[model samples]
Target: MRNLQHYTDDAFEFHKEVLKSKNTTKKDPSYKERIENMDDAIEGQFSAYNDNFVRNTLENIDSYGHTDDEKNDLLKLYSYKNSVIKNLKVKITTTAANRIINTCPNCTISEINSFDHYLPKDEFPEFVVNPQNLFPSCTICNGYKNYIWIEGGKRVFLNLYLDSLPAEQYLFVNLAITGDVITTTFYLQNNGDINNDIFEIIETHYNKLHLLERFSANINEVITSLENTIISFVGKLPLDEIKDSIIEKSNRDRIAFGHNYWKSILEIELANCVEYMNRFVTID
Candidate 1:
């Protein structure tokens, strides 16, 4: 998963603008109360988020006299197309794309198509417009991650904006050949330098996202495409030159995308396998 920079909008200012919006102020007592004490609420929200103390913050906000209708109103603020929130969403999607090829940080495959409330707005209405809590995500990852946070009392996902993704190479892929078919399987290897907490978080994130199964299912297309390219070069180039060219492409992919990227890892693995490389030589 790629790391995301939090949006730069000031939370207090954003909330103030929301309060001032005509739609928010018309016949809304909860909106009025939120406007009155937005400073405190915003501060508490940030503190809770930074400390990973969402349960406590949820409890505190539960006392804020927000009716079901009011909570729904707050949620609607995010849906308003003309709101500053829409601008912030665009900025987030653009920023993530600039950083990592428009891929979802959660899935690292699909193009980001929606903003996911990292903390569900239903549970944390006060943070509905909080830039830090919004994440640009693909529809698949966003749908799969609906309203899930803690699982069995442990945080089951990493906050891309807050958590430091371990720079060490932890993600790996193994290539296996059965008969004439090649299969790829994704895995995460333990790095001694990575703390247990971070490791557990990454592991949980992978499992919760079902990334392994997803990557494995999709890798065949890549393998087939690679084989087609190799076949085109079979009679045109010497075997050693062909191997060198493939290795060069693999290195380029690894540099363009990080070593842990599924494509890069797969390419690197294939480059090292002499048997796999030799299959191209036997073509034609």
Candidate 2:
């Protein structure tokens, strides 16, 4: 997973903008005013999240229980997320979706087109429009992560904005070559360098998101791309030189993505696999 720059928009101001754009014809015309009156309370909840987030104790914050009518209104704010995103004045959500790295930070597998509420809006309605709580995500990871955040008093998902991903290698892939078929299996191990607590969370992250399975399912495409690269060098470079080129590419990707990036990790593994490298040497 990758770290992201957190949004700096003020919570109350953002809510006001969303509330202003909401269609108030169906509900109490004063509904907007009613919601606005809760500004202090909303800011308190925002502060609660900030404090607990810094302490890595977000689980300590309880879900706010509001009156049925009020809860409905707050939930509607989240529904207006698209409006919030599209509004030029409210660029916080849009800015997040347009980050330099365009992939979902949670999986780095797909393009991100939606925002995921780190704290599900249903549970934390007061934070419905809080940019700090919204993360840019692909629909797939967003659905897979749906409403599942913590278990056993530990965070099952990492807050990319708050949690600093480990620089050390933890995610690994083991390639099994059987005759002409190759199988890629991705797994996570602490690698003796990561903190035990951090690693536990990492394990939960992979399991909860089914990342290993997803990575394995998609790895064939990466392998095919690598094979195509090797095919181009078959007659032009020796085996060692070809392996070095693959390593160089992997290194570049690791810098562009991260150490645990699935593609880069697999590329390095393929580079070191003498048997796999030899397949390129004799390609027709």
Candidate 3:
């Protein structure tokens, strides 16, 4: 779904300016006082169970709903919410590290860059300039989802912008064609130490988000059609001059693919192709 949007060059600068003025949430004094009271109540009530501990009140954040002056449960809830968000930052950063995008997908400016996590300033006070936790999106997608609780139990805004995701997640190279294509709906999968978990997440997303099944036919055909495109790209070259032509063709495609994760890989591939061409072909 996120892969559909192409990155506009120089989108980073615009976001830098926006980041300065966004996210203005703070803990209410009333909320803080209530939480302290809850902790005191829980400590007094659970004093007897302290040693034989059936369950720590601290662990009830996800299970606890809410109530006025319910300090103990509120304490746990706040703690849990903060912890989950921190862990979420780790996930976002890891995703950003694996992705490759040179421009912002949000605003259409080349000067801007970053895939911003849509968390509000109120939500994550300390994580303002978290680059890894950010995406290469323009102000559009970022401004759109700020601090909103999205569907499901998870928050609404995307942690990693779709463009800031690795192509390996949604795309692959057809060895035969050298074209980029979305993985087959049935074939979509995840690989990692948490492969099963990630796979399940992706599979659920594919269905819930209606991703692969709904993708355009051309997405997959990008990779499948590469061989022909490459040949077509080289067709008019003189027989003795064909070697340089092939190297150049690969370079162009490499850039095309590189805008996603393969951007760097494509650059490297272009260099290797050029080297190979020079070794075998001599210009007259």
Clashes of each: 0, 0, 31
- Local lDDT at 280 for model 1: 68
Which residue pairs of candidate 1 clash? none
For every candidate, C-alpha RMSD to the true structure in Å = 4.3, 2.8, 13.5
**lDDT measured at residue 204 in model 2 versus the true structure, 0 to 100:** 83
Of the candidates numbered 1 and 3, which has the greater TM-score value?
1
TM-score on alpha carbons, each prediction: 0.78, 0.90, 0.31
Query: What local lDDT score does residue 87 receive in model 2, on the 0 to 100 scale?
Result: 50
- Residue by residue across 1-284, what tens digits does model 1's lDDT show? 55655755566666667566636445665666654555675566665654443332222223244568767766666753546666666666564246434678788788877778767777777677666677777889888888887766666788776667776878888889866788887899886978888789889888888988899888877778777877888899887776678778876765555546777677667767887887666567
Backbone collision tally, model 1? 0
lDDT of 3 at 84: 35
Which window of ten consecutive residues has the lowest lDDT sum in model 1? 54-63
Cα RMSD of predicted structure 3? 13.5
Over the stretch 99-197, how does candidate 2's per-residue lDDT look in tens digits?
Answer: 355577788888877888888887888888877778878889889889989788778888887887899999999999987788888999886999988
**Best candidate, TM-score-wise?**
2
- Model 1, residue 244: what's the lDDT? 76
Superior candidate under lDDT, 1 versus 3:
1
Q: State each model's CA lDDT, in order.
A: 0.70, 0.80, 0.36
